[model samples]
Target: MNQRAMIAATALTVMSMGLLAVPAAAQEKEKCFGISKAGQNDCASAFGTHSCAGQSKVDMDKTEWKYVAKGTCKDMKGLSADEAKKMKM
Candidate 1:
């Protein structure tokens, strides 16, 4: 292949690999609420106390959420996404 063609192919391969990686990573995670430790959350709280990750001030706060592996959040005593949404935080 010409240099330009080779480069295009390589770029396409890399892009495809990256695209494939996303779902695999997503499949390994789930958003679980009421389980975050103090200052160790993965994202913002539903109640709007914070707008970013790692900002929780209380441990196991019901409004805070973190990414846990699928099927493991309930095992950790954390609330599922639907349950968390219904919970009165």
Candidate 2:
């Protein structure tokens, strides 16, 4: 096969595998976090109902609770406690 044809075939193979594997891979890596009832009430008081209400809830102590994110102090989907603490806002 010519160079161009070979490259195209390789690309097609990768694309096909990606199409079939991405969803399963994503599902496997997906994580679930739990929140405590007290934590929910605290969040509700601060951010209101919209922020507190979500599909997952983890029971956490309000005193020790520290919402952190990738690059900010605010609560976000994926954030480390250390990273969030470093964030100014």
Per-residue lDDT for 1-89 in model 1, tens only? 89999999999999999999998686878889998889999988887888999999999988899998788988989997678778874
lDDT of each: 0.89, 0.40
Give the winner by lDDT: 1
Give the per-residue lDDT of model 2 (tens digit) for 1-66: 999999999999999998998765554221112223443422332223235433124444222233
Please identify model 1 stretches exceeding 4 Å from their true place: 1-27
Per-candidate TM-score against the hidden true structure: 0.65, 0.29
Error of 2 at 61 (Å): 22
Model 2 clash count equals 7
